[model samples]
Structure formats: C-alpha cells, structure tokens
Target: MPNSLSARTWVIAATGLAPLTWGSTYAVTTEFLPPDRPLFTGLVRALPAGLVLLGIARTLPRGQWWWRSAVLGLLNIGAFFPLLFFAAYRLPGGVAAVLNAGAPLFAAVFALVLLAERVSARTLLAGFAGVLGVALVVLRGDAHLDLLGVLAGAAGTASMSAGTVMTKRWGRPPCTSVLTMSGWQLTAGGVFLLPVALLVEGAPPALDGRAITGYLYLALVNTALAYWLWLRGIGRLPATSVSFLGLLSPLSATLIGWVALGQALTPLQIAGMVVAFGSTIVGQAVAGRRSPVRSVPVAARGGTGVTNEPVNGR
Candidate 1:
C-alpha cells in the first residue's frame, strides 16, 4: 500500500522509537548485563524475543518463505546480533555505534551488486561523511581504537546491510502480515543462535536483578517489539530512508549515555553528531529527488531471484 500521511507520520515516529531503544543498549549492557558473556546475552535477547513474537503471530510461513525467512533472519538478526554484542564487549559504546554507522554505505554497495540498484555520487559522498562523522564521535585521541573490535563491528554492519538490501529486493508476500514476516525472521535467527549459544556459553550464568531486567528489556522491547516497528517502517518506506533512520540509533545512544549513564561527551563528539545528522538529511533529500529503479520482473528472472528497487519513502 502507498503510505498515507498518517502512515508516514506513524512510521517516522516509529522509526525514531527503534533507535532510541537501541541507544539504551550500551548503558544497559554496562550497567545491567554480565560483561563477559556477550554471546550468551545476545542469544537470550534473540531467542526469547523470537519465541514470544512467534507465539503471538502463530503463523508459519508457506512455500519458499521458509527458506527466504531463514536467510533474512541470519543476516538481519542471528549473525548481526551476536557480532554486534561481541563488538560491544570489545569496544566502547560510541566506537561500536560509529562502526555500525557504516551500514548504510554497505547497504548502498550491496544494492548496486545484488539488486542492480544504482548509486549516485552524492549518495556515495554522503556515505563517506556519515562514516567520518561516526569516526569523529567515537574515535577519541587514539585511545579507543582496537583492531579486533573494529573488525567485529564492521562484520555486524555488513550483515545488517546485506539484510536490508535483501529485504528491499524481495519485499514480502501478500498473504503475510508485517508481524508474521518479522516473527519469521526473529524465530529463524533465534533458532540459528540456539545451538551456538549451547556450545559456546553452555548454561545461563547467575543473574543479578539488573541483569535479569536488562535481558527482559532487550528481549521484549528492543528485539521483538522494536523489530516489528522497524520492519513495518521498512515495508512502507523507501530503503534509503529506512537506512538513514538508523543514524538515530547511535544518536540516541549518545544522548542516553549523557543523560542516563552520565558519560561525558567531548567537543569532537558533539561535532560528529552535527555532521552525522546533516549527512542523513542530505542523503534523504537526494534520495527523494530520484525515481526508484525498476527491477526486472520476477517472472523474467526465475522466481528464486529478487528484483531491486529504490528504497521506499513515506
């Protein structure tokens, strides 16, 4: 369905909420969750949340949806979630967020190759500015650079980027509700992580009150519910616009750090925020002017492949 004015407003508001919830993750991790068991925490976050959503949706995907959902789940949630937690464990919150900021650039690249979408020079330059802004915000006096952490963050970003492009390319089946579609991916991702969690983390660790609460919040609010809203927006909005909204995740984290965690922001961090926010605006404006690329008809390509289109805007 084309987005109505109210739908557009709702999606924009919902998009804002997803990132704000994401931002609290850093503070929650440090203050509440067990520090050494990042993978375990990720597993908990994905699995339980997935189960809950699946239960609510109570709809199994039909036909090839099973396979498609599984693939999307791995990229969007399974691999991305664990890798993101690993990055958080190894790096500072700001640093991890900064690295993740590269996701849009990665998305653009994947769109070009996988979806046959074209990238404008302006979008490419904006991508660089976004990365630079993230660098300015997170990299401090050379103290925060860790090669391993950076690599992990990059991997996580790539996973999510690939997922985003795939989502846009494939869209969703007509019979599926947004909730079911999201539930399928989350459940698939959770299932994928379960064995890994068992082998790696083994059993659950002793949890303090804070850790328990944090896990619940991450599972319920951040993973399950936030994902529903995000996917809903993604389905309705343009891909580029959806990707740009991701900037709010880091920006929200920065604010949460300052207000909730009392983490001090440097002057450079402030500057970085301005640039990052600016890049988002610039990207959106440029994207708005261009018409979406028409994908090869699904019939022309075997039903197995996806046709790429421009990201949806409300």
Candidate 2:
C-alpha cells in the first residue's frame, strides 16, 4: 500500500506536467506556428522530437518490437497528432479540448474490454462528471461545434486511450529503459509522418524567431519530455488513472486563457473547475485501488513436476 501510494504520488506529479505542456500547444500553434498548416505542424512536432530522442537513446527495436513499436507509434503519435491537429484547427480550441475530455472514459472502456480490468461505477460517474465540468469550462452558448472536428477529437482520444492500455499490458523489453522505449515509438511515428507531411503540406514553415522558439519547445519539452513521463506513468500506474489526468489539459488551457488572454471566467465556470478537480481525485482513488494479483498455479510456478502424472482429472 505504501509503495503504491509513493509511486502514485510521483506519477501524478510527472503526468500532470504532460497535460500542462499540452495545454499550451493550442495557444502556441495559433500564436507562433504557420496558419492552416496542421499537417506540417503535427509532423514537425512528432518526427523531429522523435529523432532527437532516438539519437539520445541510441537504441533500436529488437526483433518483434519493430512491429510492436510501429503499431504503438501509429496509434499514439502518428495518427493521434494529425487527428488532434485537425480538431484543434477546425474547431475553437476550447471546443476541441472539451471533446477530448472523453479520453478517460475511452481508456476505462478499452481497459475493461481488452485487459479484463474491472472498472467501478464511481469511475464511470467521474468520467461523466469530467465531461460536464469541461463543457462548463470550455463551452459557450455561441460556440459552433464542427462535426468533423468532433469526430477527429473522438478518434484521437480513442487511439491514445487504446495505446495507453496496450503499453501497460506489454510493458517494455527486458534490459531496455523507459527513455529508450520512448525513442522507439517516437522514431517510428516520425518516420510514418515524414512522407505524409511532405505530400500534404509541402515545405516546412518559414520559421522566424517566434516560430522557431515555439517549435523547439514543442519538440523538446512537449513531445520528448512529456511523452517520456506519460509512457512511464502508463507502465507503472493504472491506464484509467493515467487517462484521467488528461482532464488537466483543458483546465490548464482555460486557466491560461483567463490569465494570459484575459478571458473571463464566470461563477459557473469556477464551480465547474471545482467539480472537475473533484472528479479527477475521485476517479484516481477508485482506479488506483490495487486489486490482488492472481497467483499462478503451483504447476505453472515451477513446483514439483505434475504434467507427466496428471491422471487425477483427465
């Protein structure tokens, strides 16, 4: 119990930074990156960041890991980035963010189906509460939600959620650290995006100082550093619990708007923030409650040989 609590504490802190950094992406892209270049932006954010990590780690996928890495890369970074980029571009950033608030619910459902994880009703309620809270925080009566953007956001959430669950199930290779594993996924995702970015968006942006600064931050801190902690947290923590932390993305973005952009927050939005935070706390408690590990039968655990003399039942 003590060990689990200690681990959760650090995982929460590290994972929290990922969403906070991600919160800045919408603002940064609109302010500093080239306009209407979602594909190129996504590509730059993923591929270069990935290559840098690979250079640092100096590792390659081993045997079957090549395909495993590709699968994960496609789902988590390659496809996810493009889908998310489109959503952010087509809709208001807040609208895009509110749509993505469904990620934890998707994670919970996927874990339940694929991993045989038992999800509590409290977690489900928390997910619904999160959606409501995010709606309050991000949605406006005048906001026009785009259907394509909504679909893209839903698909992105689903992709990342499944990737998170699968990462937990597979863990990493023996003798490989989390950093190197991140390199494998990042590099694979970047490679996949290279041709697409060139075909769809042509040449890179004419990056001036502001654009350069923004790209550097995204590549280094948001992609490389953030994903390292996120993937590691998935490995150590419950998939649903980690997914719940994603709620902070919209919250941080809203807070940034309030402080940085001078966007006004009504009393309702403030109350919603409180509810959203409470939901995160409740969901984590429920998801983080440890279930006992199912022990392997003695025969499987290398007890005295019984296979040759298995006459009792058969």
Candidate 3:
C-alpha cells in the first residue's frame, strides 16, 4: 500500500510537468514563432514530435488501435489545437484560458458517464474554484466576449476532456509501451492537421533562427515529452485528478508572462493564482484519499499499475 501510494504520487508529479511545459507555449509563440499562422504552428508541434517518438518507439498500432489512435489524436491534438487557436483569436485577453479552466468539470461529468467513476464534491468545488482563479489571473476587465469564441473554447475544452477520460477508459495494449502509444496518437493527429493547415494557412511561413528554435522546443519538449507524460498519467491516475493539473497551465502562463515577458500582475491576479494553485493541490489530495478508480476491471488490465513508474514526487 505504501508503495502503491508512492508510485501514484510520482505519476501525478511527472504528469504535472506536461502542463508546466505547455504554460510556456504562450511565451514561446508570442516571442519566437511567426504570428497569425496557428494551424501551421500546431502542425509543426505535433508532426515532428510524433515522428520522432515513433522512430524511437519503432512500433505501429495494431487492430483497433489504428482507429482508436486516430480518434484520440484528433480529440487530444488535431481538433483541439485548431479550436483552441480559433478561440484565442476570437476571444480577448485570457478569456480562452478561463473557459478552458473548466476542463475539470467536463472531465468529471465524462468520467461519471463513461468510466462510472464517482465525482466527489470537493473535487467539483475545486474545479469551480480553479475556474474563478484562472479568470482572476487572466481575464482583463476590458476583455470582451465573442459568442463564437466561447463556443470554440467550450468545444476545445470538451474535446480534450473527453479524450482524457477516454484514454483512461482504454488502457494501452499489453504489448505496447506508453511511448509507442503516444507516438501513434501524435502521428495521427499531425497527419490530420497537415491538409487543414495547408488549406487554411496556405504555405507554411518562412522560419528564422528563433522561429526554428521555437518549433523544435515545442515539438520536442512541449508536445512530445509532455503528452507522453500526460497519457501515462491518465493510465495511472483518476481522470479528474489529471484534469485538475491542467489548471496549472494558466497559472504557469501568468508567471512566465510576469517573469520572462515583464507582464504585470495585479493583486487580484496574485490571489487568483494562489486560489488556482490551491485548488489543484486540494484536488490531488482528495483524489489520493480515495480508492483507485479503475476504468477497466483488474483481470482485463493484465494486473495493476504501469510497470515503469517515474521517480516519485508530490
């Protein structure tokens, strides 16, 4: 039991790293990447990372995973990137982030329906509090709402939430390592994005040194490694606990903007960050106290836990 708890804690902390890396994306995109080419940018992030992981894993999806990988890829990456970018374009300030902060709620609902996992009141409240905190940190008083942007943001949030729950629902095949599974999804997502990017944005933008560096960083670190960790977590942790970790992205963005980009944070923003961080911590704690919520029965899972657990943390 102690070992199980330790293993679970380590998985949570490692998975938490994904969102932290993702938080830096706004800073990298604004400062380094070319502007107004979201689809192309997303393509760069997904395709290269996917291919690299696939090369390393040297495994291909078999049987149902081919279609399952495609569906997961579209939900988690291909569709998500475009919709999120669309919301970012249409929505002002941090409105998109605020909407996305509700992901825990979506994940909770989906977990209940799809996985038959029970939602605790504390987790639900934490989800709402996280939203309020994100709004405080990102949403500017002058920010105006666009109806289309709201829809896009909501859709993106739902897509990812559903994807997360589904990933938890369908544990990886016994023969496939998490790395290979991640590669499959990334590759499929990138393939899906290719024509869309070409059609919507025309030719890819010319890249300077900084742009190239940015793309490499995003592809290698942010999307590839980060998502590998995220999907691994979905395999190990409760869907809701993993979703709450996403709240860190906005908080991370706020901090990066403040430290790296010299963006100002108001008192309220600081407080909001505190609240959001608190909610994430509390959600994890609550989840820890509960019994492991199995998306699959023990016999089908080929026994308990991922064999390769990262060094323990948080």
Best by TM-score: 3
Q: Write the per-residue lDDT of candidate 3 for residues 1-314, one digit (tens) a residue.
A: 67777777778899999999999999999999999999999999999999999999998988888898999999999999999999999999889999999999999999889877778889899999999999999998789999999999999999999999888777777667889989999999999999999999999889999999999999999999999999988877888889999999988888999999999989999999999999999988887776442234423434333434221122
Question: Which 10 consecutive positions of candidate 3 have the poorest summed lDDT?
Answer: 305-314
Better of 1 and 3 by TM-score: 3
TM-score of each: 0.86, 0.89, 0.94
lDDT of 2 by residue, 228-291 (tens): 9888777656788888899988888878878887879899899888888888888777865653
- What is the C-alpha lDDT profile of model 1 across 35-151, one tens digit per residue? 677778778878788788778878888888899999999999889988887787688646787788887788888877876656788888887888888778767664476789889
Question: Which residue pairs does candidate 2 place in steric collision?
Answer: none
Best by lDDT: 3
2 or 3: which has the higher TM-score? 3
> What is the Cα-based TM-score of model 2?
0.89
All models: lDDT? 0.76, 0.78, 0.88
lDDT of 1 at 205: 89
Error of 3 at 13 (Å): 1.0
